[model samples]
Target: MFRHIWIRLKFQNPDKRRPFYEEETRRSIIRKEEEQQWRKKKARRQSETVYDDHEADAGQNDGFTPTEGGPDPLICDVAYYARRVGLDMEEFKVQTEDGFLIDLWHIYDPAEYTPLPPGDRTPLGPSTIPTSPSSPPGPDPETKKKPKYPVLMIHGLLQSAGAYCTNDDASLAFYLCKSGYDVWLGNNRAGFNPQHTLLSYSDPRMWAWNIRQMGVLDLPALAARVLTATGAPKLGLVAHSQGTTQTLVALAKEQRPDLGERISVFCALAPAAYAGPLIGKMYFKFMRLISPAAFRVFFGIHAFIPLMMTMHSLLPGGLYGALGYRVFSFLFGWTDDRWDRGLRDRMFQFSPVYVSAESMRWWLGRECFAKQKCILQTKEEWREEDNQDKVEEEKRSSPDASPAEPESGAGEIDKSESHNHKASTAWYDHRVPPFALWVAGADLLVDGKRLLRRFASGREPHVRVVHQKVIDEYEHLDVIWAVDVVEQVGREVKEVLWATCEGREGWRIPVGCEEVGVWDGKSEGVVGGGKEKEGEGNGSGESEVEEVGRARVRPRSRFGGWFRG
Candidate 1:
């Protein structure tokens, strides 16, 4: 029933699901041997092919290394997750203008079905009823209806499509798919699966680009492919953290207004602009204030932060989650409630993929916030650049002072200075798309209020904030991986996507929506204290809390908060 003409269908029998990863179980060594045999046969067949000459020439000349020995056995993505959970997933590849082969995963369920029993069959239902006597009759009821509206989810910095599927049933991607929407997960260049048609992994050219390329080329290419495959004119977008930053770059900084017209609505979670309050300010200072070329000089051109993959690959599944939590919380801020500790291993499997050193430098360099030139720029970059002359002047005046004092000068960095005026102005001028903004109250990585005031409450609002919700105790990753995300964040995202698909008119909030908190410049305080019941237990036999009726609930300082649409 779903027509996908443009998508390259590699798996003819998607229903025959099996584990492809070598280390999925203790018998992985045997699986690896079987995979080697398959690769040898494939290579022999290629050698015997009539198109071998052309293919070889193309691969060699275009810097396509053809995965060296054989294609990777395991793909860490939504498709792999779907198969593990008894769902069907289709994999597609989109080639950007810059030659990066980005991976795309789609999970779809058909609407048609056979009658349950012979005697249960009912008369054919009418497809479309006439509005009046003069109106034309509808098509046959047996004819399949158009496919469900498509929804595309993009991930944040150091993450892949897998981020949206970490919570399985409760994840944003799975929830949308279960809600009868065609769900597609998008991967940026240099993501978990970093392959390309014309660039070899060994080639520095492959790792030369940054987030600018992502906004200018990758997002647009993926969007176009998804639209063409789904036969939909436009689709709904949900992005988080740095994902929101690049979407804005694609729409505003790159001046791709056409991309804006193609997205029905943008639901942003923890939008990553104005990062003066970034919890890992010390780490960024070590990178920017110390040396811009450190990553390249240290890691080489192969990949940035390749250890992330090593950690996932080497650590035991049970142990990795706890260790990963500590590492992530140390780098980003601590969330009130961590992702279900059970999910930490699976969640880290696809994240912290290969990013370009240039991209990292861009975030840590002179043009970060001042020019708004790249996606995911932080306030640290601006302060380092802005205070450079002053620092040099001080050094000359106090030549005999201890160098340690200047090196550890955290005093100069102003916590309140978000410095997002230029970026905000660009969004206003470019007419940024309407948004359902999710403000993470305890997120120290970015200043959420600066972003809200910039686009939502200006003298003339350029970007319409149709809906805004503040999760009082949430942090960066908690928006996606919280235990109660389904009732809190996912529900709102579902409603926003459904409303957009239904073609609702301008500036309208959904009925039965209750305001739980208000953003008062600095922090989002819960103005209501009504009690609420929690969901069923996570099979741990822990005491289950009672669920309260729809009401404004206050956030627990030690626990977390909840909101419903």
Candidate 2:
């Protein structure tokens, strides 16, 4: 239980991951050690500047370029094709601060991407789309408008869209496209992208970013291409973990409001927002003093890729079986609790989990959790000056309080919302934005109860707050991997989407009513129409019974760690 709660804490924490420890202490110690080392090295180098110059230049430029291929100088990386099906020449690598980029393999086939149970007679993306949504789903009777909004799949930290490229199985894109939705996948800045043909880590510019730039650049760029190809006005957004954090920052970065409007809906898997998990909180708090550069230094010691998981898969037989088993166990814990032996097999079969030290640092600190709340350096919270005295006074009164802190760019600590009394909002978990369809127990990183209340607050009239009351499932990441779980949620989603299909005027109403005809018998026309029959109203914790009760295997995932809250 502690382990499960600890895992959940990692997601719930937004600011520093410090639960009760005097966070930042370790970072300071490490920083001091590094500074001393740098000073000693600098002094020594100055004493022998002439000889050192030659050595420094020779060492820095000694690495080979990736295009050259035989070997990579700056980083140790493995190159491989995706093992899953339904994908193209999709490839990826897992990088570590240690400077190793291990190549990963995947398989791309439709079966791999499609959720099991073969339900959802009507698939989602382009391939599965009907000639006319209002018309029967078959060959187009009329020329196609093709969906303007393709799906935009955002990969998690250190992961690339190629992560979905499964061998023999269609990639997530192909599945969605077959389901009748257009699909577009992309790599965030800190990922593997052939487009990044000319950057080298030895060069300062090759890798330095905050989450701010992701939404401002990465997501929009991909969205633009998909929209151009499909003439889509909007696209569905799907992200996991740190990928989800950057998406939120990108959406909230005040970039293209139109882009936000163009988003069909935002879906997250194993979503993360806070940094409170004991290991994670400490990791973030320690990062303050441990620069991204320093992390690169430490990472140089460990192999950057998750090859163990892959090796175990490709070599799942006899002699090396024990070794593979051990590696598999460790990799499975990367996303959820428990070893999940079955899940380990799947990991070996799929893509390796790549993690970016800097990207993670940016997420834990800059993106969602700030020193205080404001994820973005909202001007509303900055520009004020009287906070120092407030901090001092508060500090004096409550000896345990840490004086206020400023974020990366939010000049001097302002008390606007930073009263010492309130632990920085940065430390607090992100409250779900005003309008979002949160699939609870699916582990979006938001508090289920908080999300339930926020949407249920009776404010946003058009936006309905429908939650899946789970008698059994809803773990983060299950939305993507848990075949049985998706079956449960998919039913609810299809019915909701069916019932809420827009009309001629561009409005979506609950199903059953003429304007809103596809409702799953759960939707009532009026918002929060609880007075309707028990099973008739939508998302009021009903209907999930019908969906979950029908699942086969009843297995959580390929892995088998169950969380009973």
Candidate 3:
């Protein structure tokens, strides 16, 4: 067991988290001997790297387009969550006559609101488009002041922001809406919008959602309908995986402390809130027992929607991509606490049923984070060191780390080696808990130092980028699509949207498609639309893989008759 937990974190007890868990166990044993010498040279160039069979035939019809308006969860079913899950995910069992297996609940169906489609235009609105603003002109010459708040990216849990923005190759919300930033690719409330005004579908409380009601109710009702159509006040919260668990439970439960200062800049791309018992307490004790509200009161009683669409059409797409990386590694591997090596080579650029194992059991917690739709728990002040300062004020006014972290007197952590070394460090020193170490080494989920210490600690006005790095292997949904991470993944999330839209001499950052014939002048890299051309490269940069091990979960599905009787 990791050499008996590295011999008890190398004979524990001399403090400072034993040289930070002995330098994270020697960088997890030099990242597992450099992923076992890059899986023996990618298994000896796995017979001359076949570009994953022509990038699995480019999303087979750009995969499901159908939307014409907005919010359509399930009008009379059929499309049955995009035809029985894009086709090939067996294990069906909707049995509600008291048998059990309704469990299926992944949503997102608003593809119909189309308005601006001319040879093209500019400044933000919807379909997001921009790519050149990394270093532009400035103060007024051309108006660099457009970035107020028009970003909405969100993704997480059995994810689906269209597998990291794939297009022209690797997307991340179409390179941050073509780099201007009024981007809006949010698909929450059920990974692919299952339409809900007041949570309907015969409201069993809208399938009693999870992931903290997708950031407290589908991300503040899609940011209060994108701030009443972009009048803007707050709407710049880019996330990933459980969309940073409802953006850290909607900014540590906000109801308004100026609504997290209107979130002008919060780009946490791999921020995983860690409680960890395999993604925290055995995934909320196996979805509080077999996935919520008593498995929808026995859902389908061995139903048979055309034999579950002919066992998802007789399988065989790499055995349904190895039974979907064994249910994406038995559910977001360790529920994505972090470390995400292009999640099984970016699930062949998605569309293989974009999220919905009941929205990955709603971040495992299930329900009631104040009945979601955001404005999550404000009234701030943390620490509660056995409680002494006696500050229970909270009528809803937090952020700015609530009066320099009140709630506690001795400032929490009263022992047990400072509470299991602040419970397994890694929020870059100040050992995790909020703003997640201002997002390091890329990928996509977040913590960004726990939302930058709940909106810039010390009375606010915070600005930290400190010692950043990204050797590669980006994870947490590959920071929005991972062709490269929109020009080297998060350069301060485009320098904090260019210091919140008004810094560096006019703002620039546009070359589009990697400039000069593309390959990335900086069309924001995270790559996918079938990469592997440039010098026909194949993992030579110290190639790595040996994902420790474990794939299991195949006893069925991939054509095996599930949803059984």
Better of 2 and 3 by TM-score: 2
Candidate 1 matches the true fold with a TM-score of: 0.62
TM-score of 2: 0.48
Q: Model 2 misses residue 117 by how many Å?
A: 35
Candidate 2 Cα outliers beyond 4 Å, as residue runs: 1-149, 162-175, 275-343, 348-356, 364-473, 493-565
Q: Distance from true position, residue 158, model 2, in Å? A: 3.2
Best-to-worst ranking by lDDT: 1, 2, 3
Worst 10 residues of 3 by lDDT: 556-565
Rate residue 290 of model 3 by lDDT. Answer: 64
lDDT of each residue in 1-565, candidate 1, tens digit only: 1323222274354322222222223233433553465466467676885434443333223222222223232345565555433344666777777677787777654233221343322212211111222211222258624355678889988788788876656677876776556788888887766787777877888888766677767887777777665556567899898788778667763345567766767889988766645634776665654444555676566677778777777776556656766787777756424355435567766667778877766566434442342243333432443354346446656859675454444644421122233333234344455677777767777766456644432311346555566676667787898766765677667665655443322112222223322222222222222122354212221111111111111111110001000
Q: For residues 1-565, what per-residue lDDT tens digits would candidate 3 score against the true structure?
A: 3655776787854323331345334544543553454454455467675445233232235343322211222121222323322211111111121111221211221232223333221212221112223332223334434322356666555445445433222344444443444455555543223333344444444454345445544455455445544455444566754566566554442221233444545566655643223333354455545635554443321211223223334664345544655665565442222222323333432433323334443333234211111112211212221121123222122454444454555545333443343222211222111121224333322333333332322211122322223324444544554334444454335444433432323333331212212121112222222222465322222112222112111111111011010
Residues 159-263, model 2: lDDT tens digits: 455544321122344344333343456555534321233455444444454465565555655555444434444445666655666665655423334445555
Off by over 4 Å in 3: 2-6, 9-154, 158-180, 183-187, 190-295, 298-332, 335-565
Candidate 3 local distance difference test against the native: 0.36
Error of 2 at 295 (Å): 4.6
